[model samples]
Target: MAVTRIAAAAAHFGRDLDHDLGRIGKLISDARAEGAALLVLPDAAIGGYLADLRHPDPEALPPALKPDDPIFEHIGALAGDMVVCVGFCEAEGNDRYNAAVCLTGAGVLGRHRKVHLPAAEGIVYRAGDSFAAFDTPVGRIGMLIDYDKTFPESARTLALDGAQVVACLSAWPASITNAAPKMSQDRQSRLFDLYDCARAAENQIVVVSSNQTGAAGGMRFLGQAKVVGPAGNVLARTWAKAGLAVAELDVAGEIAAARRVLRHLDELRPESYRVSR
Candidate 1:
């Protein structure tokens, strides 16, 4: 297995599409300079995310773009050889979905519309239906947006579908109801890292996670971008600031080593598991 260098970004972005693109371009260039094979940007990095996720105004939503929009082409142009994963608000006729796409200089490799909606997000965006992994230059990859990573089934489905790396782009905020004294101390901050580590360890795959930082609208984001190993180790991480978390790993070797003794995926008994509701 080849060692792949990957990066996850934690940066603040807002409603301006052109400005966001410029920021994305600069970040891509920087990642390329560092020889990163994959770069994952925060959710809604294309046009920005909602200011107040808990009670977002229906009429005042972030600008939504079509999947085949020219902006993605612009992003693709900046990608060069590195695989880039970014989130955006997807517009499909009258419905808008929280979505993320993986692309390279060639074109889009795969797309994922967020299947899980948190709090008032359900009021503004339509939920997606499924999870699937796709081929990329670096490895088999999958995507999840924001609240989607909160569920084990989401990442599990991707891993089961042959995803070696899962890029989770999130516009996740600090505690909405109970504001913490420090960003690091926030409840959601802990949950964010916990989920990232748990998902990677449980499935024995690499996890690239990114989130928004600073405040957009009234919501303050926890900018803890990170790359986690299959052994549940945080290979690289960024604090509550706009920055990049970069790591180099032998993806296939790491997964093989982690699963050598305890093959969690192979040992699962799906037929016996049941959900009451």
Candidate 2:
């Protein structure tokens, strides 16, 4: 296949849609400067995430927009030739969903509504039912939003559907109960990187993990954006700061190299393992 430069962002977004759009434009410009073909922005890139996870105020929730919102068109226009995966809150009648969409200059390639929800998310957003991968100029790509990447099956399903790269978008915060004085020592910080590496290693696919940094209401987000190789190696990273983690990779070539001896997907024993609901 072809070598592609991919970027994962670590930036903060808030309630102001106009401000968020401007921040996104800057990130897009930065990625283009790095010659990135694919760029993955954090969850809630458009409207921001809930202020308090345990007690989300419905009155102050992120602005919900339709799937075909003109905002997306603006993103597509800005994306031009580069493929971009960004997170937003989707509005459908009375129901709302935490979702991600993949797009380029032409139009949208695919979209994924977050399926797995942490306790507080359900109070505001409806859960999605399935995981699917779609073809893009970059490759067959899949997306996961925030808590979705916590489940091993989530990324596995995307891999089974033939995704070469999985973009994990998050507005994940530091531990609510056990806050660490240092960002490096934070519990959620470790788990975030662990999940990214594990998902890529297990699936033998590239993982572009992007997260929001800085504080939002009572929550303090950890920005450990990175690009993980199929062997679970962190190719590039921006740890505990706001920046872009860019890496040039030959997706098909790397996957092939990693799976040559131990093909994890092909060697799966689905029948022997007990399936969970």
Candidate 3:
């Protein structure tokens, strides 16, 4: 099926969940106008990446800092013909999770909890250990939240599950600047770019990344959202802005090219690649 990937980098979440939902609604409306089939929003697009909004001290947050506060219903309502995937803070009893929720034409089809939490993430959020992919109307989709994108194993799991596109929702720091003095910043960007591109090229699938933008709390978010084609070519990209990137992926072409080029799927080296506990 033909699809368009929409990436939106916008303002931080507010206490008014309805307002945030409305803003996202507008984004989806815009994407739909452009004929987009999938909307991939940044991490914590609903309530702001809670870790960034939270104080270093866990005690600083309120008792009901998180729970089903109507955002879910609003987001659920937004799902219809298009598939929407967003990162948000998930509240489960006394604990919270850095999670990504997938809303397809059917409804909330799947959720993948973040397995690889960054250094300070463990301070306020609980890490999740599951790696899974869900079937979507267009194709099978996989999700990875922020830090989990750094590892290839996560993408491999999704590819193994027959996912044609792996979507990443992230809230990364802007320390990776493009300034002359901050050459390392460019390096950081390239690192992630190469990682995502390699995942698509090697697996013969597509990779769509949507990251946050602007400053929230004391942290500056880096927005470098893009889509990599099966051939590792950048199909669409946004240069640190609140915008959308649409790209059409060729699932059949990817499968055919993968078999013609690498043919690794037929090269059974699983015994050698397997790790011992």
Rank the candidate models, highest TM-score first.
2, 1, 3
Clashes of 2: 0
Per-residue lDDT of model 1, residues 1-277, tens digit only: 6999999999988888889998999889888888899999999997788878778877778898988999998899999778999999999998999999999989999999999988888898999999999999999999999888999999999999999999999998888899899876899999999999999999999999999998988888899999999999999999787889999989999999999999999999998898788
Sort by lDDT, best first: what order?
Answer: 2, 1, 3
What's the CA RMSD for each of the models? 0.9, 1.1, 3.3
Q: Model 3, 1-277: lDDT tens per residue? A: 4434444343355335566687788878887887777888887787665434434556543223343455655676776778888777787888878887888545677788899987667877788987888888768899988878788888888888888888988877654224324423555556666776887877777888888777755666667778888778878887666677777656656556666857545664787887779
Question: lDDT scores for all predictions?
Answer: 0.92, 0.96, 0.71
Tens digits of lDDT, candidate 2, 1-277: 6899999999999999999999999999999999999999999999999999999997999999999899999999999999999999999999999999999989999999999999688989899999999999989999999999999999999999999999999999999989998878899999999999999999999999999999988899999999999999999999989999999989999999999999999999999989689
Comparing candidate 2 with candidate 3, which one achieves the higher TM-score? 2
Give each model a TM-score. 0.98, 0.98, 0.86
Instruction: Locate the minimum summed-lDDT window of 10 residues in model 1.
Output: 51-60
What lDDT score is found at residue 208 in candidate 3?
Answer: 85
True-structure Cα RMSD, model 3? 3.3
